[model samples]
Target: MPDAARPSPNCQSSHNAADPILVPGRTCWRMEKADRVAVIIDAAAYFARIKAAILNARHTVMLIGWDFDTRIKLEPDDPMPGVPNELGDFLSWIVRVRPELTINVLKWDLAILKMPFRGGTPLVLLDWISSRRLRFRLDSAHPPGACHHQKIAIIDDALAFCGGIDMTTDRWDTPDHRDGDPRRVRPNGEAYGPFHDVTTAVDGAAARALGELARERWHRATGEMLIPPPPVPAFWPDDLEPDFRDLPVAIARTDPMADHEGTQKTGKRGVREIEALYLAAIAAARDFIYLESQYFASQKIVGAIIDRLSEPDGPEVVVINPERTPAWVEEESMGSARSLLLQRLHETVANPRFRILAPVTEGGEGIYVHAKVLVVDDRLLRVGSSNINNRSQGLDTECDLAIECAPGERPEVCRSIRSVRTRLMAEHLGVSVEEVERTEEATGSLTATVDRLIRPAGRSLRPLEPQPLTETERRLVEERLLDPDRPEPMAATILRGATVFGDVNRTAWRIGAGVAAAAVVGVGLALLARRNGLGKKMQGE
Candidate 1:
């Protein structure tokens, strides 16, 4: 693997502070009250909020996502009189009901193209674009081989949602994550894994900024300018009431433009912003660092945490991921890398203050972890589209909101955020928050919880046992590592090279060959256009 030490221009001097000193009573930042922010805990809440925003939109609706399934129902069981249940039907109804309103949708072109069986069906969206006042486009051209992986929705420039959640089937789940709940429906009647995710809703200036982001995406996708939507009426759902008012929120966004011109200047890769933000938050942490992410494969971050753990006064670090990667490739590539990284960290920290956990229901259905959140010292909080993985930081465009809590302000808001994380841990361990807290208080940190549940009798720490991989799984993992665009190319190349000729080798070879062929085709097309009159025309010669 590449020496995880590539000099990052985004790296700043770490502020090795012990804990965040509470700022005096509710120091209101220059942000507006209408510019409030609320964290949506799971996919269900995310979709419900988007549905509400769309329904309440007075002038415009804009959406951008890495993946979107029109077949997915926004309101699975809500008996609302006029609400459309499924996404496609709901969108169509919105156009029909509000003919004058403009709506735009943009999705990653590759993701759309991946579903070849649905060929020309995107024409349905194109037709909607043509027939109604709606506009739909597919975005493909980002940094070469990179993806536009942001998920956002802006309604009439009055409300916006930004996060890791995608509006696809199998994503909706309540916080309860009840085992084998018949109420949860999979499109093909196949049972899906339990999952968790988070998104943010913001109004006021921050909302308008998100609208700008949607407009920028639309322009990149279609070369068409988007006009800002007119202001809309306050339509906050009764269920989404603010946990605390007058909270100070910071709207932090990531884009290629910033990389190309901003202070960090990590080139077309926006991972630097995500990394810098994470490291800065880590240094700023005082009490503890609580995070929930789909994957953990960044060794640099693990190193940083190890450094912190070496400090006697450092805050605790907690991570939640699925027990195993869902696919063979992930298991081999990210799963193995994470396993090794965690072991290294564990070895460095004598007491093992850091932890990685997976949530499971009583019935043994593995929770598909997808939430992207960070709570630092109970003062700094973030919820957004980026994961902790390498792809999210470097190869994909992501956006997140980071907020600093005002001292003596609604401390309950901070408590609420902590409660959510603790509650998740409780669900996984089948223990109560009070119990976890009591144990932590007695033992000094989360290590006690892990030691109690995971360790064998008379053992202080559990042995670093790797998940078993089948031959097919091993081959898939090898292939993922060989891919340069993946997060850990060095590890992938080494591991995959060793098993590239095994029984599962053909499958890996085919996939690699396909990606290479696509890259050739893309480059050939670009060169041909440049040589012909097409490029000149595109350049407006």
Candidate 2:
């Protein structure tokens, strides 16, 4: 980690030729200085640190995510005796005790469908109605079939967290990720599989910038402008250790251009800073690129990787993904897209310069890899909610925090970047950090080190072999109906009609229109399947 005492004048200077990849308005929204920054691995540590920071918040607490369940306990394994353990109860208790504090939560509106199943969430929200300071709003300010997928939390505009870990059920898991851990259970006591995720926490100017971003999102969703809270003392967790200090963090976003009901749309064009950042970062890799994402189905990203591998001295690439999505529908769509991309990679790259792997438990159960992280050599590190998928590139609302280590500047930052990679590799391989470092030093190749460490048994990274795609699956991947890179024009047209036309039976009309649209899409897909003989294959003919 970089020393706190070291001065970073070059990073603090105005944007110029020093910073290349994190250019504002192109690859990022803004660049701001951070007093301290830490990459919180897994939800266990993330939840605990967030709880601590919120407790210290004096004015505001903003929680934005794809989903939020008040039923889940923040620290199920290690609970405090007097303090509230459940998330809803914890927030409620804070507002009541503080009196002057306000808590605002914004979640994807579609996630409300699951609220009835989330025990105590409705009751908790009902209780919150008594206090005007505690507010909850659903975010539907997105295009049809798009979602607000960024997970973020801001505390008094002094500290903020942005990343893939959502404050919901089945996300809490320690780095150990032991098989059948009793603590890995839902609020209803049902055991869930081990999950791996990451989030970055920052303080100072970067946190303030994130706060502005969160406020903007809230205004768009609820049509209520929020003022920034007065600057407060640092709320850094007592037990947490920062990975970098005195560094400049770039904020990148992916926001689709869509018209909301009550708010003025920003413009015709959408923000694709996240996509630009990914392409530039991938192209700038010198030695290797290490990626950890939930899915690998983006055509642009895959094309960039292919371009790099085609180079004679291109950087080696290593990707980690889940063996397959847990849900059947996602497995068929995203999983099939992955298989096709992998086949293309294999066919184009002559030498073995790239590999995709999945993490496994000691019992050989596949651990879900939900962390969206990218590390290019030892110069750049990105951690956030953006996944390597088509939707994340341009359709979904996403945010990612990136830090770059310029050549001949801040060697400590470079070391910290390298440490992040080694630490993650150690956790996945079930080995100590020292062991990973030693092996990598001995081998002098990241891919070679991984190949040497992975064994036939115990917890290890298993190389994922792409499944042979059937004709139906191949058509699905090529069509990309499930993972379109932009808003579906048909769906958008229907939405605009519902908004522009007034009717007494507005709800019914909207529902009927949605059904008609779905039917049209479904019929087209059915025809495709029939043409491919999928119907007969499914019927066992």
- The numbered model that scores best in TM-score is 2
- Compared with the true structure, all predictions reach lDDT values of 0.63, 0.81
For candidate 1, write residues 312-414 as lDDT tens digits.
7777777777777677555656776666556556555664567666666666566778888888766777778777666665556777766666556667777
Angstrom error of the Cα, residue 380, model 1: value is: 1.4
- In candidate 1, where is summed lDDT lowest over 10 consecutive residues? 21-30
Q: After superposition, how far is residue 192 of candidate 2 from its true place, in Å?
A: 0.4
Q: Which tens-of-lDDT digit does each residue in 1-541 have in candidate 2?
A: 0111122222221223245877888888889999999999999999889988888889999999999889888998788788899999899898989999999888876666576787668778656534468877666667766778999999999999999999999899999999999989999999999899999999999999999888888877766779999878776989999999998999998888632221236665678888888888877876798999999988778777777777777778999999999976577668988988887777667548898999999999999999999998878899999988888988899989999998878899999999998999999998989999999999999899999999899999999987997655665566565676777677664554444333435433444455466556645544553344322222221
Query: Which candidate comes out best when scored by lDDT?
Result: 2
